[model samples]
Target: MTDTSTDRFDFALLQSSNERTERRNRRLLSWLLGLVLLAAASIVALVLYLQTFEREEAERQRVADGQWLERMVRFHLRRLEEDLLALAYHARERQTRQGSVTDLPAPDPLRGGTLYHQPDVLLQHGWVPWDSSAAPMAKALRADAALDPENAAALAVMQDTARGLRRPSYAGPLLDAQGQRTDRLWLSVPLFERGLFVGTYVASLSLDQALKAAVPAWFMQNHRLERVDDQVVWANDETPSPRPRDGSYYAQLELPGTQIALYVDALKTRTPWLPRLFFGVALLFLLGMLGAVLALWRDIVKRQRVERELQAQVALRQAMENAVTTGLRAWDMEGRLLYVNPSFCRLVGYSAQELVGRSAPLPYWPANQSDELELVHRELMAQGTEAQGVEVQFQHRNGYLIDVLVHEAPLRNAEGEALGWMSSVLDISERKRAERLAQQQQEQLESLGRLVVVGEVASTLAHELNQPLGALSGFANGLLNRLQGGRIGLDEMPPVVDRMAKLADKAGRIIQRVNAFARRREMTREPLELRSYLLRVLKPTQRERQVRWQWDLGRIEAWVDADPGLLEHAVRNVSSNAVEWAMRATQGSDRAPTVRVALVRSPQQQSVAEVGISVGDSGPGVSDAQREHIFSAFHSGKEGGMGMGLAICRSVIEAHHGRIEVGIDPVLGGACFILWLPLVAPVTT
Candidate 1:
């Protein structure tokens, strides 16, 4: 009985131990299954989060790209509008000058040059008269317009709008009869004459060609650009691809005085599966949490670095702005000053605090010039920019005026919207002062040169007066001797007195000629026939010298307006020099001393004709080296010459709006002098 009881106890104890082992096993399996389920749920959640992040990132990138493309398209379109406006301006100028619009030459921008790069983009461009007259070119353009009636109507509306607004206007991405968009667009720039609508400058553009021209290749690599309607449907001929609907970006391209809606579809890209696969295989949550922390830390570090770089850039820009010498100023459209740089403050002799936010008639504006400055400010606000800067005087704080050159340009934003005007002010007081000094110096030098000319001509004047005075003295002495000796009768007294009177008149005329040349006084000019004038001037020279005289005058009847006394002096000087040189050349040779005089008329195209007075002498020819300074003041080649003969002749001729030149005479084989005077209307009978 004791043995059987012990066996029962052992069996019961072994069963109890097995039951505990099975319970522990079931608990362990339950915990293992729960852990596996939790890991799977975490991985699924991470994948969903990554997909959402990727979609968000792609959408953001698309938006940014679309904005950039829209800006680029608008920029090019603005450039096109500017080119068209320039053409219109030129056409208006032509019409104003030529009184017709059809006379315009072929448009340069239409010629497929680098100015927009894409060839054959401009289909047609011409000036369309408001009257719709039957001009051949205008008629052909109208016929082309009639080919597409709907587009023509749209273009006409755009033109009317442009005329009313006095600005450029854009019309369709044209449509076909089936209501589908065609590859054509229109632009019109209005023409106005004295505020009257006269015509419009029209242009036809190929939409596809313009797109190809304006959109860059790099941007097209990742995007397909398309014109979209109100419903975001493609309006172009290109068929849509099966891209993700979520990856599209839309923007409105606001051009100058117009708007175009555009959309870009991001190209389909294969989803990368490698990272997802790696994340699944390396499924330890601790590793993922550590990676997240590391990524956050790196992102913080990157942001800090970027912030430091941005700060550095800002500091650099500030330093550059401060270092520049050209003063910078900004104004709003209302003429209110917005900003003034340090240089501008220094230039105006006022601090930035004193100038900023002030409008026209501000502190730096001269009190006397306020009205003019205000007017200029209004004009700048109206005209935006004047390429040839404005030169104005600004008063300094110390009551001195400063001359400043201000170059204005329209201030615009990234959207090409004009804000106001930005001006670059340059202090030109020193330069202006230097220019004034140079002008004064030039005037002083001119005065000194005139005085020197007078000094040089004094000797010639004395010599001229000596002969006439000596003749008068001889006549007076003879008359006195005759009267004192009682050998003169009353009848003989008349001849002697008449001779004395003529001598005195000659002396008076000589003195008058000298005074006229020396003072350079305003001349009293009259019509003088060249043939008669030449004859009169040469008679005395011929009488004084025994040289042979050849005359080529008496046929040409050219007339010149001239002061008789001054003209006679110039002619006499030239003839006298010719006679003297001819006599000298014949001294050692058997050749006869000869002087030739001629008058010829030279006609000019669309200008007053000139009359030439040529005097040739049989003397040694002028050398090339002597030609340069031959007419300069105090320059002479003869012994005992005052050197003012030719110089005085040149000055007198130039004062009469004529010129004198010297050259070798082809016929005489000697020096020749020619005086060119403007031919005038013939004297009436």
Candidate 2:
């Protein structure tokens, strides 16, 4: 009985040990499987965040950019209206002069002295046809010459509005020479004099570059624009808003502060991927979670297989999510598209099925991007692997080019060698479009202002030229009469001949000045002494304004290779401007308006000498606001001037390896225009 009990005890001990060992193995297996599931879940979560949340961020950015463009356009429209008001004022003044055929009213003494000094600026090329692109007077003349009496009457009405300083806010189709009515036309404003409407001065701006700019790039981004015949005059950024109707439609809205009609584009087709991209993020996130759970369960069935399966599943899911959210596309070495996702397709206005395995389309690309596309392809194919983000153009089915920031990554298989490329296409089309359009508008505004000045100065230019000729004729006639009548003996003829020669030379010089001023200049340079030139140039400009001139430039050899004509013009222009200011200080006092000039060399630079040429008057200096951009192009502080002399002078000095700069707040009470030219030094090396 004792032996049987011992045997039973040993067997029971063995059985208990086996059951405990099996339980430990089960727990260890579960722990390993749990770790695998956790890693996979992490990867899946990252994908969900990247696709769903990040995509929303991108869309928000695009919308914000668009809204900014819209606001910009509105700003431009406001500025345009203000300019139109100025146009009206100008026209009204013209009509006042034009009305009542009695001899023109005697000019005010103060205003009359400076009236004929206005400068003429070039307006446009000869190729431009008669339309709104022409100046106010040019347009008016065209209207007066119109074949249709009704059209002429309408234009006449516009002229009256211009005369009254009102906006010319009319747009309609115009009849061309071929008798076809065309939408390409201009705005005509009527001019009014003291409640009596007189004539119309027609004015226009080029819509090609200018109109686009006035709409504002931000507005274009915010609206949808369908360019008819390659111009954006009819629509804006708001045109892209989603529409319920299946067919194309149009709506019109009156623009703020503008009588111009604004049309909204009603044409939109749902991008198959747009809806998918929107809901795909959320749905994929949930589905991905489910997939993670099922995948984890499968890993439990097999041990080593779990690592490979889980890794593969995570990679594929990440790829799919990236493709959907960030616009994934794959291309071969030959510049052919291998694959494209819904995101990329929608960006270019195409379906994935249409873009995949095709070459990059040219039509969808933004304007002027062929070279960029070609370079990208060459670089990618040459090195067998390339990754970069550069701007590219994409074509839409409707032929509009879309701007994009393209991100490319090399694709490699298990061998760890690059074969092809995968790219992320980001649509920056609206941003680029807005920026370009804004720039264009700014240029147009500048051009319009230039044209106005040019028009105002035409009469002045003719009078200015005629003065010298008249003086020469009178002097010649007097000389001829004296010689013919034998006013004295042969002895008088020498002095007479001398005076006649001087007078004739004076006329020639005046003609030369006019010719130089009228032509477009190509500044040429040669070594010129500064002291005498400054004195000679200043006399003509200052005496015209009756300003006394003083020069304190000590003996200095300021020899420099510079355009002599341009330099002389610069000195004259600045001196003239200073004299005007000085005269204004004393309220045009005949009591000697004085402008003093000083020249000094800087102490710091030895090998290079600084010739400081300054113009100082006994007048109040430039305003704080004006000082900042005193030398900037086309900026003027005074009324009825070209606003170009100082700016052009600055350009000339800088080009001659020097600079035209402002004085250090003109000491002792006057505005100063300072010019610094680098003197040519004797070679030391």
Candidate 3:
């Protein structure tokens, strides 16, 4: 009896346990079903929300595109109107000058050309005079207007409106022969001179042609354009449609003096499957929740590793910035300072804290130059950046001025959005000082060269003076001997005195030429007839040498503004050298030494005319090897020569804003030196 009771109790316990297990399994299943339902509902809600957002976005884009198209059309129209006004002004001027309007030139509607950003849309254009009896329109224009009585009436109304308002007026959608509306627009621009209406300039425009030329290809690819009033569908046949849709965008083209509207229809587009795609992704996400938990831990480990690498890159960049010596600076569009590197702080003798965030007319700018610097800053901000660097003076914190060269570049982010300006500043005080010192040294060298040229010329000048002085002395001595011997008669004395006077005059002329050349004086520029000046300068040199001189001063007189003394010296040196070389080359040859001097007007240079003084000789021409250093100081081809002559000549010519060059003369068959000076306008007396 005890065994039976034990067995029955065990069985009841086992059954209760099994029932409890079944109840727990059922509750767990119910909870899972509820979670799955919630997930599905959330996914549906998200899909609907995305669909709504997409519709809003598309609507916004369509509206924006319509506005842009309207702006483009209006801009083109504005340009066309400007071109028409210009044509009217030209017509008025032509009538005023010609004193008649009967033969006015045909109007050019698209006078501004590509500047109007449209193709030729004009069908007919002509000048319409105020009085039809005085001047009639072209036959073509007249015929076009007469094709339909409505067109003529519309043109007349537009002309009357333009005349009354003293501005341009538009009329039509002109009617066809069947009295049906066409895409033709008539523009009447009134021609007014001195507040009096002279006539009307009229043009017929094809609206369809205008639209095709004005709208961008990219815009037309997605939108079909049409007139708002007519609702005529205009489709682009060139580009294939990407999808299919039926929508329209509307915008008003706000012309300055006219009311016009345009209708832009969105092209056919396929319905987006983004909502369905989102729904599928959401379902997959719910199914992979356990995998996502594992992935989250792995992602956290990868994020930590990436953070460590980013910190290392940051440290490396900081080190590079510190190592760089060039001063780096940054500023915003408003001219407010944004950043400064350590090198910049060291250069300005100021800390980054004191320099960053500073605006224009900062502490580093010199007090007296603050206004100028601020103006420059404003211009830089407006223009973005300069191709060439700006050189400026900056004051250090210790009260010393530093010459700095700052190169500016537009600072942009990864998205190509302009942040401000980035500048690379370099301290150039030492370079500036060196440049000034070199300039001073060059001036000193030039002065010394002048002195050497004078010394060299003095020897030759004394030899030239000897002949005239000897003649004068001989004449004086002969006359004195005759008077002392009492052999001179009164008639004879006149002839003798005349001879002495001639010699005296020659000697005086030689002295005057020498004084003019040798005297060092400040530059005194004067307008000179080049022909006359060349004659005077070459006379003394010709007399000194026996070379066959050829003169070819053109009839068209060339004039120049030059310093007389300096110009004379340069001309004399070049001519003298030519004569000397000719004399030497012809010493043992059968060829007679010849020197050709010519003055001719040179071709225009940058709109400024120039006159060339060419001196050619029959001696050996300059060789290629010597041409490079021929004008250098202390470089001479002649034996026992002071090489400063050509150098000094070059300096003098450059001072007068002229240039000198050497080449082989075709006529003389020898080296030729040509001095070119800017020609001046002849003074009318």
Candidate 3 Cα misplacement greater than 4 A, ranges: 1-315, 368-379, 382-388, 413-418, 436-454, 457-685
Cα lDDT of model 1 overall?
0.76
Residue-pair clashes per candidate: 0, 44, 5
Candidate 2 to native Cα RMSD, angstroms: 49.9
* Candidates sorted on TM-score, descending: 1, 3, 2
lDDT of 2 by residue, 1-685 (tens): 3667655323222221245545765686577557656756765675566567555655555445435444554455445444444544554454356743123342222221111122221111111111234443554446533855544555545444444455444333334556543334345544444676544433343332444644545444444553232122443332333322322222222332223333333233223465456456655655675676566555544433444455556666666765674677787766677887677666677776666667753345555667776676677555533344676667777787667776667777799876688877777867988999999999999788767645434533443335456766776787788878878577766776676677667556544544554443565566667777777777666556666677788875566667776677567667777877788888845566678888867678477777878888877778788878887645678785545567667765676777776653344477877788877653222
Clashes of 2: 44
In order, the Cα lDDT scores of the candidates are 0.76, 0.57, 0.76
Local accuracy of candidate 1 as per-residue lDDT tens digits, 1-685: 3567655323222221245545665575566556656777777877887788667666777788888887777777777776776776776666667776556566554433323455678777667767857544466445545667866776667766888898888777666666666666777777777888887777778867777778777667767776764343553347754432655676787533334676687765435466566566657664565565556556655655565566666666688789999999999888888998898888778998888788877998899899999888888788855677889888888899999898889999999999998999999999999999999999999999988767766766766676678878998998899889999899888887887888788778877877867776789999998887777767876887899898888665888999988888888888888888888988978899999888866665637678889899999868999899888766788887767778778888998899998998878988999999998889988
What candidate 1 gets wrong by more than 4 Å, as runs, is 1-320, 332-334, 351-353, 368-388, 409-421, 436-451, 486-529, 536-548, 554-565, 581-594, 600-611, 618-640, 654-671, 677-685
TM-score of 3: 0.39
Error of 1 at 226 (Å): 53
- Candidate 2 — worst ten consecutive residues by lDDT sum? 121-130
TM-score of each candidate?
Answer: 0.45, 0.37, 0.39
